[model samples]
Target: MGAVTPPDGFTFDGLVAKLAAHLRARGSLTDARWEEALRAVPRHLFAPAAAWFTSNHASAPRGRFALDDEPAAWWTAVYADTSVVLQTDDGAGDPLSGKGLFSSSVSAPGIVFPFLELLAPQKGDRILEIGTGSGWTAALLSWAAGANSVISIEVDPEMAARAAANLRKAGSAAQLVVGDGVKGWPEQAPFDRVHVTVGVSDIPMAWIEQTRPGGVIVLPWHAGGLVGHQLRLKVVNETTAVGRFHGTASYMMLREQRYNTRWSGHHHEAAHRSTTRISPRTFWDMDLGAQLLCIALVPRVSWYDVSEDGGDSLLLYELDDHAAEGSWAACDLKAGAAEAEVTQYGDRRLWDELSSAYRQWISLGRPGYDRFGLTVDPAGIQLWLDHPSARTWKMQT
Candidate 1:
């Protein structure tokens, strides 16, 4: 943002042309407006140390950590078409040592281009950006639509302030607010598009309430039980939303949405006959089921992880039904004169049923997420894979 010499070969115009070309080759970028936005905004001003994509360790820049002291190295790397770590573990680590949780980042140009395509912000539309990391995306929106058209919030004060400064330097002209984005700045309600950089588990009722009818909300959503399930979603109605998996991603869950890691003495132990007799791949997409379950059982339940000891058969791991405090594991086994075998503990049978549902979907023709669309109304939301085939998942009480 601040006027810095382009450092010889790094003229801003050259960077813009190169960025546009790189984006074009990725096939994820299409919007002309985005190119213009990239040209206008100064990426190097915000990025401290970008992760240099290279053939081997020697060529790749060592990231922000290495560039912290080396100003010229930092400047060149920051301008490249890559992501730079803006915060780690909430800004506790030195920007010089790459030791952090990557709390915030100026997403790689590859992602920024596609996401903007998915967002498709129109002129005069009010845009609400959830994670104001580096303020790069906000600057883009402000440049494309005008500064007054965008409202961005950051949960971390340091990141928020830096983003604000960057936007100011870029002359972005957008309103920057510091706070939890899940609350969706009510003051700027009815946003035409809401973009959340961080992933969330709960679909806040506030988001639905703030957006005007038909306004779109793009966000990353956590969808699974056990570890985590990341999915992108689009708001479709005042009370509902839907979307499909675009890519595998994991982010620090929202503060309020963070799951409890404590496993003992917290849930009820359910009675179940242990039985294991299935393929490990059968549970390939169990997290999808868990995601649907989370959307259904809000305020009370969520997926818990299950650990396992070597059982008498083939055993991997499983999810815990927190409401029931029950644990399950799939154990695999083999004997002198027998074939490969599997055993189940706790409620492993539930897993088989869950797997069967996915198998049925595959048999129906393993339709990718693209086919699945959303139809949301006051009554509820429907997952519309196809017309007439528009269906709704049962919301559990």
Candidate 2:
């Protein structure tokens, strides 16, 4: 945010305008308020001078870009519509090496503007933002709303400190609170809007309790499936909130919402084997709606596609299931095979569950993502198609 003269041809203003045009062409920068906010906030100020950037191309190499070492590259990446990696391995690994878990970063402008438009903060609305990375989004929210009308929270003290310094430089009056965002800042209760940057697996009752009725909560939810979704929920009561999925979003999970990745090979040994008429593609090639249905009905189950013996297969892992441990299933995906092989282990029959969910989707005519809606209430979270009272699945919060 500090005054930094851009290299002759790479004027910062020019870069901002060009980026805005690019986002507009991509159909992301639609709202006038957000476009103005984007012009007001300098993304380069929030990003590190020298850090790694996520590659838009799948085959491109990864490494760090520094203003001092590579000004052109750094400036180019700063203006481009890609996320810049701020820290890796929770700041333990060398971020300059461009290798490690992307713990945090300034989000890509493409996603940032879309989500901000979804939030639709008014001039004087009080907003609560979770995961204040780089303080960029907080500054944007402040611009759309009013000065000091936004309260942003960050769980990491180090990241919070950096964001605070960035905010000062940007002259953003948005208050930064260093704490767990899942708790939802209660001291500033009854906010008009709640905006979350991190991916949420479990819906917190505290968020519903803090927002006044008719308020809105927008977030990227990891609804127990291969894909994550962007959601907008309207607060209907002290204990209830409802909304529908907007689009696909694959964000870094909130620290607490992350699942255990320690998988053992022994689970495959004591498995029950069967053949399912359902193709592995039923899960692997599922459209957004089908995936949402599977995620809703089959809770706490995560899946991935695998290739074995020149054949494709889908693997499922049971997460947070107290009834059993090391629960998993593998379904063969041989092309044009009427019945594929399935191997399931532990107390949970994951293949059976997925197959059942797929059948239900067929019976209901296989709706798309728009037909799926989420509800959070005193009775826990529920996912339903069409209407709230219709066929619904209770999600674990």
Candidate 3:
């Protein structure tokens, strides 16, 4: 790799170099080949002309930045270690318009390199990449695995086209397919690795079937309705894959696997109401370990918290509701109160399940997220602590 010339009308004054050094210092850009790829594939070339900025995952996007409109700010954000939202509400609404979900983004350098490190693609390795959001990671994978070794799938046709153009301009030979990534691109089966860029609630068996034995699949596992986890699984055979969690990662949920966030309009006239000694903070303030355990023990739920009336309130929504339609729960933590009021509006009693999961986690010695591992097979996915067989529970498939 020689000197990388910046795109026309853009001046990257060692910014990629600076970004590389930053990732290295942060211990994410450890591989020499990956570092070279980072230098070769300038992120600016892949970034969109207009995008939204957010300081961190916890904060909402501040405002929009356009390359032609705000060159300096756009350049700075492109080089900095933060995600840039490419579209919101599936391109129907502006990101900063105050009412739209973040549908696409160029993930921060911090998260991207870590997953790439976990992928560890080898030269000439056939790689299948899910969610070719900005085409940046695909380019990097092509650089690592050599030309024509990467096949990337994107669900959104518009995003796919944009990514295809970006890959072409970046000189990456990675093939781009505009289709649902959950299906795993069967035409190109037996891939050496599967790299997912979106959050997956359920591990698609198609991925396992497409991957060659001993192949690795790395993704952001969305579970427990909390912040996701970095999951790295090795295909043990045709029917099974097992791996452990690396750390916390949050990404946009895969479109096909996305949970319904809209409130189900049902009058809770006869809904069960109760009180619990468990405070709302117990749910909202749970560390990553507890959150991961809850994901295993109390699967198929999403939660959100709010500060209200000088206290915290936690709301749980059912994602896999079947018999008990629209099961939901709300727990309120009044300041300086020992017990919290709980309300259940469906048959599933989500709050009770959450409390039970929390107690189970406590009884198991409060293991951290690192101690847990996932086993995905034809029967179902299972979560275990310490060892694969040591205390396992079937996760909602």
Best by TM-score: 2
Model 3: runs farther than 4 Å from truth?
Answer: 1-13, 24-27, 57-62, 95-99, 262-268, 320-325
Alpha carbon RMSD to native, model 3? 3.5
- TM-scores vs. true structure, each candidate: 0.73, 0.93, 0.90
For candidate 1, write residues 1-397 as lDDT tens digits. Answer: 2336665456778766876786687675688878877777877767654333211123334444334455456555554555676666676765445664556777767666666777778888898888888889888877766649999989888888888888877888888998878788998688878877776655676777777767777666553343333334556666765665454444556766554333333222443334344444334344443334333322223333232353233232332333344444333433331333433334334444444555556655665545544444455444445442465453322
Candidate 3: C-alpha lDDT: 0.82
The clash count for each model shown is: 15, 0, 0
How would you encode candidate 3's per-residue C-alpha lDDT over 1-397 as one tens digit per residue?
1123444555675767777787888786788777677678888788777777765433223466677766666776778777878778888978655358889888888799999999999998999999999899999999999999999999889888888888888889999999888888999789999999999888999999999999999999996566888999999888899999988888898987777764352557877888898878777768777787787777788788878779888888888533336788888878988888888887678889888988988998899878889899998899888888898889865
In angstroms, how far off is 330's CA in candidate 2?
A: 1.2
Give candidate 2 misplaced runs (Cα > 4 Å).
1-3, 56-62, 261-264, 321-325, 334-338
Error of 3 at 98 (Å): 7.0
Specify the poorest-scoring 10-residue window by lDDT in model 3: 1-10
Least accurate stretch of 10 residues (summed lDDT) in model 2? 55-64
lDDT of 2 by residue, 286-329 (tens): 88887887887788788888877767788888776333476788
Answer with 1 or 2, whichever has the higher lDDT: 2
Please say which candidate is ahead in TM-score: 2 or 3: 2
Backbone clash pairs for candidate 3 read: none
Error of 3 at 49 (Å): 1.8
Q: What's the CA RMSD for each of the models?
A: 5.9, 2.5, 3.5
